[model samples]
Target: MKIQTKINGHLREDEVEPRLLLVHYLRDVAGLTGTHIGCETSLCGACTVLLNGEAVKSCTLFAVQADGGEITTIEALGNHEKLHPLQEGFWEEHGLQCGFCTPGMILAAYQLLCRNPHPSREEIRKGLEGNLCRCTGYQHIVKAIEYAAQKIGSPDA
Candidate 1:
């Protein structure tokens, strides 16, 4: 199958097997390794990425399904020079321990903050219910989202 999709603001056209998972396409073909593969099942959001501006688990969808769509992996979120607000929030708030789930957590939080720029702690918790982190126990993760929300809601941000 020939899949053509815009990933991380770049247009990608590649030959892939029908069974190729979107996660593999991003990691193997697209050379974006930021999206991690934890369980390969949808239960773990470690493989999460934004598909057409909404976060979706890359491991659950086939690459062919993403053809002609736009995907945003963690690589597109920020670079070394300037970090995304969420990335900075994670760093400032110590939101991660192992760092395996940070990308997915940030992406999920990205969608949350996009919809609700001033989300309360409860709302933030609810928004990130789909993504799990074994290291931080979610306290720091919530703080990280809150930090990003504050930064985004601020005029200076």
Candidate 2:
């Protein structure tokens, strides 16, 4: 199958198997390794990405399912020189230990802040329930999200 989609602000068309998982397409085909494949069962949020502005588990969807859609992987967020607030938050708050789940967690939190720029700690917890992190005990992750919310909502940001 030939699928065309916009990824990380670039339009790309590629031939892929109909059964190819989106996570595989991103990592193998598109060469975007930031979107990790933790639990292919979708139990782990390590495969999360923004599909058409909404966060979805890439492991749960086929590449063809994202045809004609806009996808944002963790690489699109920011670079080393300029980091997105979420990325900065993660770094500042030490939100990740192993760092395997950082990308998905940041993307999930990105969608959360987009929907509710100012999410309460509880709401942040609820918002990120879909993602699970074995390291950091989630306290630092919550603090990271809060840091991002404050930075994003601030005029200086």
Candidate 3:
């Protein structure tokens, strides 16, 4: 199957197997290793990405299912020179230990902030419930998201 999609603001067309998972397409064809594949069953949110402005588990969908859609992987969030607020928050708050789940956690928090810029801590917890992180005990992750919310609400962000 030939699927066309906009990834990280770039339009790309490629031939892929109909059964090819979106996570594989992002990592292999697009060469975006930031979107990791963990627990392909979707129990883990390591493969989360923004699909048409919504956070989705890439491992849960086939590449063909996202044809004509726009996707945002971790690479789109920011770069080393200038990090996204979420990235900065994660760094300052120590939201990650192993760092395996950082990308997905940040993306999920991005979506939550987009929907509710002033999410309460409880809301933040609910927002990130789908993503599992073996490190950090989630307290720091919540603080990171809160920090990002503040940054995103500020004029400089």
What's the TM-score of each model vs. the native?
0.98, 0.99, 0.98
Root-mean-square deviation of every model:
0.7, 0.5, 0.7
**In model 2, what are the clashing residue pairs, if there are any?**
none
Report the Cα lDDT for residue 19, model 2: 95
- After superposition, which runs of candidate 3 have C-alpha atoms over 4 Å from their true positions? none
The digit string of per-residue lDDT tens for model 2 on 26-108 reads: 99999999999998898889999999999999999999999999999999999999999999999999999999999999999
Better model by lDDT, 1 or 3?
3
| Model 3 deviation from the true structure expressed as Cα RMSD, one decimal place | 0.7
Q: Can you write out model 3's per-residue Cα lDDT over 1-157, one digit (the tens) per residue?
A: 8889999999999999999999999999999999988888888899999999999999999999999999999999999999999999999999999999999999999999999999999999999988999988999999999999999899977
Query: 9, model 1: CA deviation in Å?
Result: 0.8
Leading candidate by lDDT? 2
